[model samples]
Target chain A: MTGQFPDDLPAGQPEQSATHPLPAYVPPPGDSPPPDPRTAYAPTALIDLSIPRRTHPASPVVLAARIVPAVYLGMLLPLGGLWEDIGLIPAFGAAIATILIALVAAGFGWWSWKKLTYYLDADGDLRVDSGIFQRQARRLQLSRLQSVDAVSPLIARLLGFVEVRIEVAGAGDSRAVLRYLTKSQAEDLRTTILAKAEQRTKSEDATSADVDGGEYDPAAPPNPANLANQMDGELLARVPMGRLLGSLLLRTTTVTLFILTVLFILFTIRTQGVASLAVAVVTGGVPLFAIISEFFTYSNFTLSRTRDGLRLRNGLLQTQTRTVPVGRIQAVEIVAPLLWRRFGWVRVQLTVAGVGGEGQETGRAVLLPVAPRDEALAIIEQVMPGVAVDDLPWVSAPRRARWREPFQWPFLAWAATDQVIATRTGRITRRISFAPHARNQSVRVMQGPWQRALRLATVAFDVAPGPVSLSALQVDLPTARGLADAQADRARLARLHQA
Target chain B: MTSHVHEVDAAFAPPQENWVRVSPKLITARRITLVLGSLLEVAVIVALWLIPGIPTWIAIAATAVFVAVFVWAWWLIGRRVRSYGYAERETDLLVVSGILIRRLVIVPYGRMQMVDLTAGPIDRWLGIATVQLHTAAATTDAAIPGLPPDDAAALRDRLAARGEERSAGM
Candidate 1:
């Protein structure tokens, strides 16, 4: 039955070459291959919920490593000047104090690690019990599980451990982090959680089948074995190192910095003296840091399709594996910078419901950092499934709107299909955002004083916060009203159809 | 002015002219708050005037500005209060407000996560309350203020029931 899905594969395929690496699932040393689908629910040794599990024993070392550098720098740098004034004995005492602090932090870390234990409850809810004094116990419902990501910071990677982050729907703090698990253990845990979550979702769907008018078949439950073989999923897109670097360099900020640096050098030479270059350094440093960070974050970015959802693996210093479940994406945006357009490149960003607040440095919202136009469209199609990007009945903003956004007016357009509402804006960067009608939270029509005078309005389709922002700017008043109303109606109908 | 009103009506028209206008007492409530705030500002300026070496003209000018602003706000309050209206459609709730930046927000019942009913001291005294609809997206700012307590409660119950029936997962 699992073979019907072509992407699903049998367990334990040989690792792919290093050039295009895949997350090869290596089962625990003692356990055999995953059991057959027809068998009753049997917890494997790797994912035995009856036993409470602890992270790697080196968890204390990892915690100490994270804290020691901050302590050393914070104590040593400020005390360096004071040490000259205070004397050698006190300086040595200060150094000893810093070591004591580090030791205390490590001790606390060890205590917490020893105390912390996580297990899956009978209802398939993940319960994490921790805190030395408070004894905090958190139960995360599997039914609301949005995504499960395995993240490895540089030090954690060196120590052969990964942090499994589970994000559930609702609230900013709706996330669970299982820190410092072995790489294989993290993989197994992610697979088990996702499979269980899928089963829970299927069961819920079955229960709601009456409301859904028998749209969901209760008989066809997902095969956990197939989901465990996520390693063998087909690769959809992989960003090359060269393209990632090129895209970073071609950013508008990089260009502006380059121009500023040249002007600064020329001015200095003309003055025939070393001028105050504080302004130049301050201006150039931020973008340079941003570019370097972006490069490190997006290097070796690979996106693949799994039975559970779409899996994204990226990062140089801190490798992160994020799975965005099927139909979980709320919105998608494709951005093509002016410079990148020459190379036929664009970047794809997504707005998943609960996968937010992880910060852009993790590239959580970035679907593709840089891909050719066609490849970008193909990836968007996969993410949004059934929406045609190239072909849409686009309606450009009325001619009067040009007065408001003179340069961007020509590019300002909006399109509404039965499935998605898309808006295009920006003259230089050229951004096109698509929000599925079913996922739209609300519709808004707004008009500023100037827009009122110009008889123009802007319509916005709201979704859960991420990178994608969909709005039709400077549209004619009647058209904007019509669009908003039609969009609301479409959203209502789409929600009904989905139910 | 009539033409402007017509344009606004055309732009933000609900299915019909069935918009349930907010309480008229909202204007009085807002004006009282505005006057109190202005009086506080004037008091601060008068206190600064009592300071040694402070110019009397500065305090007088500040007080005059506050008076002008207070009068302007008082004049605008009624219009702004009148502009605030909400319409309950079959599947969504429409909230239209703001004079300078006219906005009409339509939040589908299925997307509503929570319905909050709140009453400030002045609102409680005036027998009015605010009903705020929260969706998954924070940008969905749909708050209908200055509804009579009974109406607010009834609206909250109706919205809650509809939200439950059409509840969709984020």
Candidate 2:
């Protein structure tokens, strides 16, 4: 509250600090020999003892997972060029060849288990070396390595191993992926590489020479910004059941299934029962689909903090993993949908510097599926420090509501518009309730220009991700404009920094 | 070599023969080659139709469309490949490109994450290669196109060295 950075944050993870201290990083030795072939170019830490170790064959079960690829390739080959009319013997032979190729590939898949060995050089590069038939040694100098992505695949999940992929600079999908390693091994590998890079850097320059030779300036610790470790709670919001379920039903496949089920039941029934069953299907479908949709939308959603980047892993059938380094996030925007406006919730997205569109791996990266209204501003504060979002107090706006009550009917003719709660092609969709929940409290105001001139205010209250009807209080419009303007000004102050 | 300098690292010096620079001229030539290649493709399609059991009108329509598309494509591809330009700035590297949406990407010197120097068949044929610059952030990545082999390698080496230099805070 003193407007000064606290020496200590609210709290940081004890385990995170003990395991990931910045000062002691060293790289593991990989394939490259340590004879100083390219001069004393990189530091000695990277030139560890064991780089050219033997390739450990993959497990047979690893190949079993590859059945998906084999089956896909098997179907594609005959259609692609293999089974063409080069005579029945050749065609039949081609089919046989396809199976043989699949078998050989499956065997190779089992055999090509890989471990990428890495270490940090004194100059601050995380060098990785790995390959099977043809060994490829890739050096991602510390500065160029963007994100260190760690994931647990279905196999790794059960086997207690984690796969790590390094996102490095340059083009054409250059990444060093280590398929199977213990969780501890990955953490060590990450530490060693970064540490070596930092050390090598220290070894450079006349001033650095004195520092590396060993002098500890407590005030200017090696990584003075190491205190940034205290910054946590990057999580913006949690996606609740209502919005998640609503979105699922909006998908084409789920709706199509419902339509199909309706047709199937109607035909199966007799004439008298047909109409009743048709009504029953429609009545049951909305709630059933909503529940099913919620189940589909957020089956296993978890966002976690890594040392150098943010890791997002999600999916129902095919799990996808994406890691974004702090440096790459461009613009962050929080959008509150009409449903969420009812709950005062928002969805956060970060614009990333890249050609690809949004995905776990793409731009305007989704930060949180959902979060509370007030928490949105707080999350933005930690991730992008420079953007200043003001916490201001202001008036509210008036909304056009359709009503037939004695006082409402005549007032509806000259209603203050532009305050839409839930609109379908410009038509309002009424809701059951609009009162704010006991746990969730927020100040709301709405205004139109004319209403603002008359000092009118319309207050809307809701506790979930949808507009709550019959709970808005109409006052002067000027109060609504003042409040809306203040909020807009606060949003304008936020920025999503460029890459 | 200029003498009198003491304790110089011989590795810093350039070789006796100079490396040819890849110019915009070859980019134009590549575009021309594309036109020729398209013509040859259309000719093959026409040739197939001209053979004894095929219809002439189908071949005519196909060749007509191919030629039309090729004619329209020449200007587009020429301008796009022509617009691709790369230069090393004091602070970082710049790659400016685009036919429709102009883009001038500036990768800061200190932020460069990796440089991958590559030469495929077409590059070897043209006596040129490419350098891809990647960053920790996926979005800020760029490729320096069409440098003569030695120049590309030298650029990579320089960038790698500079990358290390800056990262080391030197």
Candidate 3:
């Protein structure tokens, strides 16, 4: 049987196996047979969440998200008071209203408390139930569990709690969340989930090997990261403290917060009345609150690994915990924010079978909030030992030229018209800047109509390809042709390796 | 009984689908019908103007807005109609559609995430079903339009039998 970079073919390309090989970087030949995870592994850890659960940690921010409605109603109580004075009354009236609001808050708090518990059944199943208003319960057999995710809000840390969500695969989506599991519980939960998935994968490898009679790589020795680095620990990377804060302050919510805050100030200035003053005060106070809260939000973020899988933990107010087995990861993407171009802060996220599908993939399950270059490398090694990331030559895929490429006629056609119309309205954009991206951005070739006019199209690659990088091809016409040609070419070359 | 008209024409029902076909004419007719609808809207604005009690300015402004909207709607419909196309590849089925950001989704026969045939009121009149194929990567949702409802339903069933995956994601 062949080993050692089987088709070590050219760059940005892999030979599709004459037979789809077990994912790479697995270990060498083993002595005895392995087990079948599906059939042999215990189903104790598996579970499908019954419904949506409240496993979100009670981070003041998350709680605040839920509380926005309540807070709005409370302030508007005066409006209701106007209605009451206009002769709308009932039994304990305002008292009842007040009680109702209080009850809703109390109800959510109670449910958050109750729904936040998650545990594994004996056979390696992970189960979670959450939500007070709408009770949700899910069960995932441990074998199919995709990833263990933990998000620690800054508040959770000061308050001593963390939120954990577990994802799984199959007929129905089964998942569990522990909103405010203790740090220890969060760690334990991740460990247990990882342990279960590992067990199942091990069993599957064993059985599938016996049945198929083909070579399969067992997992790398349990602790590749530590073994590779020795006492140096995980190599580390980070954006400067200043750059990180800049990004946090500029995220979608932060931008909206800033915009509203500015609008409130403008209103406060325009009308020197109590109503305007109150509006200004509330709006002005929010961004400050957000800035402060976000400080602790990403505080103490850390990522490392043991033999089992990768572990990430961080938060100032609320702690979040997440675990992902290397086996579950479909691919990884290293992303750079437009602003981070200055500091070179790259965000790393993974695409796994279960993550990044449907759920916006909340998928950027951040591995490193900010890191030095070497640190990111160390982390990559820990998560994926066989597939290399650091040393390979990084080539920017061809899709970055939307503004200059001849084929960009379509987008240009739209852009030119849009510019003219906006200019006529005196709303001209001073500068229309296209984002500068790195080579290796995920390039995908998807052919729809224009793509098919020439029989090609491509999706821009988002720089890094890890476990879930399968979808990031640039689907431009040439890329599509390349894909078709490459598939055939790779197939032919793979046959040579086998022969 | 089990499938088609001219596509097969061996004397069989078009097929089974949740919604019935309105007619193929709707594809092109809708374009003309929209023009006709815009004319109706124009007639309404003029009637309001002619009726008098209504302010002349409001009628003019309303008519102008309606005309702009009608033109915009026609543009959207034109683009959407033009973008719709589908083709079947051997081991996989391909559906091409999308207006502004066009998409061509390929679902290898066995890689179907989920296939659903749905019909809307207008589509009902057109006798067609919009079939959507879900994949793990939602950005590439493959959809084919204008299939006779019955064929759409059968294709949906066939895809379900052949399609791979959980509805949530990939």
The number of the candidate with the highest TM-score is: 1
RMSD of each: 7.2, 20.3, 14.6
lDDT of 2 by residue, A1-499 (tens): 1011111223322333333324334334584445322222222222242344322234334444445445655655655554455444544555566566667765665556544455544445555665566776665644434445456666556666666666654454456666655665555554444444344434452343322112212333343113223212133334555555554453344556567666657665745466667655765576576656555545454454433345554554334445554444533445555445566665555544431212233344566656675675675555444233332121122343322122342222111112111111111211111111111112233333333333333443212222112223444333333333332222112110100
| iRMSD of prediction 1 | 3.0
Of the two candidates 2 and 3, the one with more favorable lDDT, higher being better, is 3
Which lDDT values do the candidates have, in the order given?
Answer: 0.76, 0.46, 0.46
| Alpha-carbon DockQ of candidate 1 | 0.41
Error of 2 at B170 (Å): 18
Clashing pairs in 1: none
- Which CAPRI quality tier does the interface of model 2 achieve? incorrect
Docking class of 1: acceptable
User: What are the candidates' interface root-mean-square deviations?
Assistant: 3.0, 25.2, 12.7
- Candidate 3 lDDT, A1-499, residue by residue in tens: 1221221122312222222222222335684236333212221232233233334344333454444445556645656666567576633355556556656765667656765545555555655655667876666776555456655655455566667766654446555555666666565455445555656656777665331112223553322121212111232333355656776665445666668877877776787656766766676677778777766666666664422234455665455545443333433545444444455455566554333222333244566665544566555654443333444322223444333334433222101110010000001111111111111111223433333343334432222222323332223333343343233233223223322
Candidate 1, residues A327-371: lDDT per residue as tens digits?
567788899988999999999888874453332312236788899
Tell me which of candidates 1 and 3 scores higher on TM-score: 1
Q: What is the lDDT of residue A135 in candidate 3?
A: 73
Each candidate's clash count: 0, 51, 118
